[model samples]
Target: MPIAFDTTGWQQHDRATWFNPGNGDQVTLSYFDLVPDLPASLDDLPKLRHDLAVVVGEVGCLIEAHVVRLGDVPALLQVVKVPLPNQPSGQVFLGSFTVPKADSSAVLKLQAAERGMTGMREAVLVAQLGFENWVMPHPYAPEVQGRLPFHAGDDPRFDPQFADHPLSRLRAWAHHVVRTARVDPRFAALPPFRPATQPPAAQPPAAQAPAAQAPAPQAAADTGAADTSADVTGPTSPADFTAPPTPTPPADFTPPGESPAAPEPEPAAPEPSNPAAPPGPAVGSTLTTVVPGLPIGGYLPLWVGEQCTFWRMSDPEAVLDKLGLGALARTPLTDRRFRDLVALDASSATITLLDRYRAEDGSTGGSVVRLTRVSGQEAHQALTTDTLLDAFRRLGRISLAAAERGEHVTLEPGTHNGDLAEPYVLLAVEEHEGRPVATARTAPPPPPDTPMWQGTAAVTAPATRESVEAGGLLAMYAMNTWGEHPLRLCLTFGPR
Candidate 1:
């Protein structure tokens, strides 16, 4: 077989001899599967047309990927990159032996898409535009899925500049992946794997939303929810509340040595006023794409912070194969990004994003503000449950733009009191400190009818009054902004 290591730095490629480079030529069902593309619905697409331009908008490759085994246990040798027809380039990525033997390719694709979803917002929803042209769904299909503008085939050359293009972002994403693999003991000890295995059973796919063969009819209850799909506020949006009388609690509520001296004081260390409430369990959810026309991936990992945001990507099938669905899909609420931002907050420099703005310059000249810690009582009200994603997404967008622009930042750039008006949901605010903590999660699953997927955002905690109020609006805007790719797929700088 044409041999080489894939992105994950593991043995990869089909076991078939056609995978061999020694053979002059070979043909097999290996090529039967068409490169994937976005589908509105199977019934909606009576014929397969390979028009990435029609499928997605602007396309930029993934820049980097940080892969970790989804579960505690691991197996199999998985490859994570595209193989050219020539020499091999062993890229380090993550995959599991446990992935069902059946149609592993589709699972691998899903797993790769998931990896993209974890660290960066753009990692999910792959764009079809400016992509290369490959063969159609079934080379002889009545309609073709068409080809990407160019083939990444071996010996093919692209402008060196494209190496840095988002279209080719993973060129380096694999670098760290290999570094990670060398240390991953499971990788070092895998038994020689035969990529060829028994095809998967007829079990329903985890990433594919609906049962295969036929669509499950929606229940009448589903119809009611469908009408209110735009409510956006979630289940808690409707509730009853009344103002409560407030009074000073006992002196025990005060810290030692800080309580007011009383002629006859009730002396005691301040007791905890309130303990944190348990966050709700995973709830039924609905997700949408940030970039319109982008093909949905298998998994979504959300990262949120005071000013940083990321979504780490992994292949769901690989994760499932190695870790099982429950393991990789833990979909942890607090990801590394959130924890790092929390750590950064300890020494964070407050930047007034509103500073240096001139009304003439189209920005309000804002004031100075400090970053403050959120109190237990204030966490919910400040970071409100529904809107956490807005803040994180806005930050994620700005962070990327900042890197692209190579802009250095010091203190919070906002005027001492100026606010950063971004397109996101605000979660928490320390007005005294001028710090806002926002949280958001994402779920990018395959389509309900087909094995296609995208994303859903979940938030924890609350923001200041303003942040909470704007959460709904932010969610709506997010849906619209990323709803579609604005252009044709695969716009090559030159010719195809």
Candidate 2:
């Protein structure tokens, strides 16, 4: 059935696909023609549920299932949770509605996977089960030698605890989907569904010798297709779980792919320390000679603001350790203290710290710092010509008036300007002979209390010798945040 729902607060990734802004939760709609092995009759909801459990295997557990209706058409609603095979500590909660017809079916699915609550739920189960360690078979799955008896008190399916849990959120979204669903008149006109005595069999190997082998059925995630495969019985390994490949954009669009390495550092240049004073330009260095990009010689980009500073590091764990928050590296993303100390930004290689320290007034305040890491190639391209132009094309483009005037200019989202609400860049240009040369520096970050939704206030400051140099180019764009982190549309890259 052609279905539509309230997609409020969801960012559309592509056709029939959307993702939650910050949490990495995803939802999609898809159609199927004769799910390979399902009972033909849509009325056999129990069989459908059983088949779902079997198809998901031991790696996943069915939290709930119900025979529901999409408009007037009957459908099966299922909630399943599966741990990601790749991540050390994370689980994906899947909620799906399958509407089956005589010859076709449609599915609307939602996937939510987060760090903090997954760990907490697992810990609660482990503590109650008395498991020797965290890595153990699911408590509710087919019993393993070391698996403990399932208890209703702590079981996520039975317990009404952790209301804000990802699974709980998925269930709520499912209800929203069902309530808001609309059916297509053409689909509803199709013949009613009827069950066959037995499910269809696959073609014999000898019968299809000349043809390519049928690929194994995969998890219906990215494409939103129905998963059709034989029941996985007995024990199943973690590797059996299939996850879709998700693209992660880089923090700066300078390209993370192979490029030339940075040139050797000067003999007197010092290695940039984690929390140390950010390295400065060499003595007698000028904006014309010293341009900012990614730091060379093992140094990182550092932006010191009035309320906070932005730092770039090669390794987040090592830098966090020096900040005395080594434990944060192991903490869940949902922990209260962890969330309090850290704010979500782009890139796992980066860290946004709100340090708890006493100010001169003896009042407790959090000193905010935004840290990001860059590859040698990304840094190299930021200072080069050809690749830099290519990377800038992917972002919202803009042109600064620095070539004609060295004064500050207000920038807003529009044609010839970035898509961000405010311009966070400072440009300085001077005429050399008949040609114009320029330097671009980042403005200080907004105050810690400034609401990001409202956008950071315009920052005006002199260009630093470390800012990127624009010999003749006067273009700029809002830099992209990388990794699975939500897009901030912050950070400005100029001279491309």
TM-score of each model, in listed order:
0.17, 0.37
The CA-based lDDT of model 1 is what? 0.22
lDDT (tens digit, per residue) of candidate 2 on 91-120: 567777766555655567777775532344
lDDT of 1 at 124: 19
- Local error of candidate 2 at residue 167 (angstroms): 0.6
Error of 2 at 318 (Å): 16
lDDT of 1 at 224: 24
TM-score of 2: 0.37
Note each model's CA RMSD in angstroms: 28.6, 23.4
lDDT of each: 0.22, 0.39
Give the number of colliding residue pairs in candidate 2: 6
Model 2 CA deviation exceeding 4 Å by range:
125-160, 198-496
The TM-score of predicted model 1 comes to: 0.17
lDDT of 2 at 42: 52
Per-candidate count of clashing residue pairs (backbone under 3 Å): 110, 6
